[model samples]
Target chain A: MALVEIKNVRKSFGALEVLKDVSLTVEEGEIVTIIGRSGSGKSTLLRCINGLEDIQDGEIRVEGQQVHGQMKKLRELRQKVGIVFQAFNLFPHLTVERNITLAPIRTGRVSKADARALAEKVLAQVGLSEKIDAYPEQLSGGQQQRVAIARCLAMSPDLMLFDEVTSALDPELVGEVLKVMEDMASRGMTMILVTHEMAFARDVATKIVFMHQGRVWEEGPPSELFSSPKTPELKSFIGSNH
Target chain B: MQNLNFQQVLRYQDEFLHGIVNTLEMTAIAAFFGLLIGVVGAVLVGSGPKPVRILVKAYIELIRNTPPLIQLFVIFFIFPSAGIRLAPFPAACVALSIYFGAYAIEIIRSGLASIPKSQVEAGECLGLTRFEVFRYVVLAPALRNIYPSITSQLILLLLGTSVASQIAAEELFHTATFVESRTFRSFEVYALISAIYVALVVASRVIFAIVGAVAFRWPVRR
Candidate 1:
């Protein structure tokens, strides 16, 4: 079964349709990259998958389970599908360790000591073990994003969503986050990334999807999509990226 | 022809002290209820549904627009005619709570609104229920941001306790009036009571400052 599936998903804000009949499937352990123009519903699609943005029609399924408006079911789905935002979104009041441990302790009902241990392990994986006691504001943007990834990882999610994760980082800081993501991708994690970094998308994604006007314009293996395009829209979008 | 008698002033010292104690008690009760009403009203007005928000706004505007003295009269004197006769202390407390609560709602609403949207979204995305979000994220930061305004309002309410005396509550200013009339030492009596009121305000300010420092240690310098 596909790890993540969006079946005829449609979303609108007031009168404007943001995502129109979008459908896709992501298999387990595959890296899927979604590339699009600024208003192409890429972020909205990611938000819909994570249950952050409610959909007006259709359904999303994660790990073969339907994701919908029910709180308990959505929370259970969220425990398996971790999402990281462009803004990092670490809790400012909590230390790095506490930020990583919050959900594991709260939702998972893990003991404080065990949660701390898991937090330390993930923090070390992200190369932020030394800054365990630091607050979000004290860390550089790259370090904060690393902590955010570690935070998601601590929940033991089966699928991870990265919505322009490197977009907010300094140019010099982008490489470290991409490197962490690359490492996660290599470890057989199913990830759907909404990104503008064409080169990274080309290199890391098993399949690349191009979105246009709230619809999937074209999708294929990265080599074919990035190099030779059958559609003029995909060709023009790639041209504009350079 | 000296009209002042020193012995009479000393003879009424016990009653004078009782009035001071009564004033402090009334102020304490009023401050407690005022803070409670203020916080709950602020939270309701700041976060509730549209109808509740409108109701809260209307209540705040109504209370703030009317004078507190008139409010005391309505509560103490006018209500009695309608068979709602509350004793002086309770009536004074209810009046002050409603009055100060309206102003506090405005102050704290501003604080609650000042918190960034991203912060709230971050908490929500982390799977925290709305109540937990308010308790841990919204209220703590909102209270910290509005601490100065709230403290000032509280001290002002303490001074406003004198208005309760007009309703025959027998607080500090009422005692001063009685003392002045009995001893014929108007200047000395008024001056002493004014000094004591200043001392009480100063003491409450110091205590509040210490509490603010301890409670909000995470946000502010120690």
Candidate 2:
């Protein structure tokens, strides 16, 4: 079984359906990039997997544990599925180290000392060790996103969800965030990304899923999907990007 | 013109001291109950189901629209027929609490509403339970954002205690009334008590400022 399985999921906001019969599987240590135009439900799908948005129908299982409807179990699943949002969402009141260590201390019941050590280790991994005491507002957009990544990594989640993580950054800052994500990819971390960075998606994605009009329009290895998309929607989407 | 007895008025200073103590005690009780009702009502109105929220809204509107003096009279006079008999001090506290609570609820509810949804979602995604999120994320930030409003409401409640005099609660204003009547020194007695009330308001503000700096240190500078 895959590490993360989203089976036959359907979601709607009032009358408009955002995801229709969406099914996908994320294998361990694989990098899956979901690409589409705006309002294509890529972010919504990521939110459902992370239990941020509840699906109207079907199940999302993180490591075989159902995430929807079971509120108590959802917290446990969320601890194992770290999600980085487009907006960094760092706790502005806390320092970067405290932001990273808060979940481990509160949820995992790790001692403050141990949590700080783990936070430092992950900060170092993201090349943000020098910013342990800085507030989120003090950091650059790229630095803030890197700190957000470290925050998720400190929880030691089995799967990481990146929802347009770099889309909010400055044009010059995008490459630094992409570098950090690529480093995580090289280290064999299973990641699901909803992104518009075509080159990074082409280079780092093990699989690329193209979504259009609230459904999976096409999906395959990045080479096949990028080079010779089967569906007209996928072709046009790739065409618009280039 | 020399018929006025300033010595007797000076000798009854103990009664004035006792009145000050009584006023402080009443204000403390009223403030406590008012804060409780404010926070609970804010939560109910802010997050309750639609029907419950409507009920809370109606309750707040009813209290806010009616005068505190009239509400005090109703609680003291009318509630006795309903088998709810409270002594003057307790009745005053109850009435003032309900009166001030209405305004505080609106202030706190606005604070709760002003909190960005993203912060709550971030807390939820961090694996914090809903209750934990309310405690650590929601309430802290909500209270921080509304500190000025909360303090202002508290100070207003403290001033509102003057209305309890009508119920014969024997707080500061009631003391002034009694002392002025007994000594026939209306102007001096009232002026002294006004100064005391002003001092009390200033003192409470200083204390709250200190508490705000300590409790909400994350947001407020030292």
Candidate 3:
């Protein structure tokens, strides 16, 4: 079974329909890159997968378990899926260590010592093992984003979602965040990301999905999709990225 | 002004001290309850279900719209007639708490609102339940951000305690009236109590500053 699957998803913000009949699937260890223009419903779909946003119509399943409206079930699914945002929404009032351990410890998933150990582990993974005591505001944007990723990794999530994680970083800082994500992708983590970094997506994505007008316009292995575009929108989108 | 006589006012020194103590006690207790009500009411109004939220909104509106004096009258006079026999002191405390709680609700709601939406979303994405998110991430920063406003409200409530004298609570102002009636030292007694109220306000502000500093020693920036 696919690690992440969406079936006939429909979402709208009152009168404006953002996602109209969206569907996709990701097998375990698949790195799916979703590339689209700003309003292509890429981030909304990511939010729905984690049950952050309620769907008007459709089904989302993670690891073959249906994700829906039940609070407990959504939480259970959330434990397996982690999402990092473009804003790097670290709890500014908390230390890097507290930010990472809060969820695991507060939810009683692990003891404080274990959570501390997990924080250390993930921080090391993100190359920020020494910055555990720093506050979010004190860190550079790339470091904060990396902490957010480390914060998510502390939960030991089976799947990770990155919603334009590097979009908010400075051009100089983008490389560091992308490097962290590239490392995660190399480690066989099943991941879906919405990114404008075409080069990084070209190199790391096992599957590249081109979204246009709130639907998947073209999707396949990155090799086939990039070398032989099937849709004019995909061709133009790819052209514009260069 | 006529010649001032400190000696006459000093004769009621014990009474003045007693009143000042009473005033401090009433303000402390009422402020505690008022802060509690404000925090709880703010949380409920911000996140409670539609019906309860509406009820909270109504209560805040009702309390805020009417005069504090009227609210005191209802609590002190009407409630007893309705068989809820509260003593003058307790009634004064309750009245001030509910009255100030309305303003507190508004103050704290704006404080809570000042918290970025990203903070709440981060907490939610971390799988925290609704209440837990509010308690840890949202409430801490919200309270911190609004501490200055809340402190001002608290001091204002403390000053507003002068109105409790109408119910014969015998706090500082009431004692001043009693002393003035006995000694005919109207200006002196009133002036003394006014100075004492100022001191109390200053003292309470220092206390709140200490609390704001200590309680929020943790790292929370807006």
Best candidate, lDDT: 3
Better of 1 and 3 by TM-score: 3
If both were scored by DockQ, which would come out higher, candidate 1 or candidate 3?
Answer: 3
> What tens digits encode model 3's per-residue C-alpha lDDT throughout B159-210?
8899999989979999988998999988988889889988998888888889
DockQ sort, best first: 3, 2, 1
The residue-by-residue lDDT of candidate 1 on A1-242, one tens digit each, is 88988999999999999899999999999899999899999999998887888998988998778887688777777777888989988877678888888777877657886987898899988998999888788889999999999988988889999999999999999999999999999998999999999999999999999999999999999999989988999999999999
Per-residue lDDT, model 1, residue A109, is 55
> After superposition, which runs of candidate 3 have C-alpha atoms over 4 Å from their true positions?
B217-222
Interface RMSD of each: 3.1, 2.8, 2.1
lDDT of each: 0.86, 0.88, 0.89
Candidate 2 falls in which docking quality class?
Answer: acceptable
Ordered list by lDDT, greatest first: 3, 2, 1
Q: Write the per-residue lDDT of candidate 1 for residues B131-199, one digit (tens) a residue.
A: 766766577778888989888988898899899888888888889888888888877787778888999
Q: Alpha carbon lDDT of residue A136, candidate 1?
A: 82
Q: Report fnat for all candidates as fractions from 0 to 1.
A: 0.17, 0.55, 0.55
lDDT of 3 by residue, A99-217 (tens): 99999998788898787788898999999999999888889999999999999998889999999999899999999999999999999999999999999989999999888888988
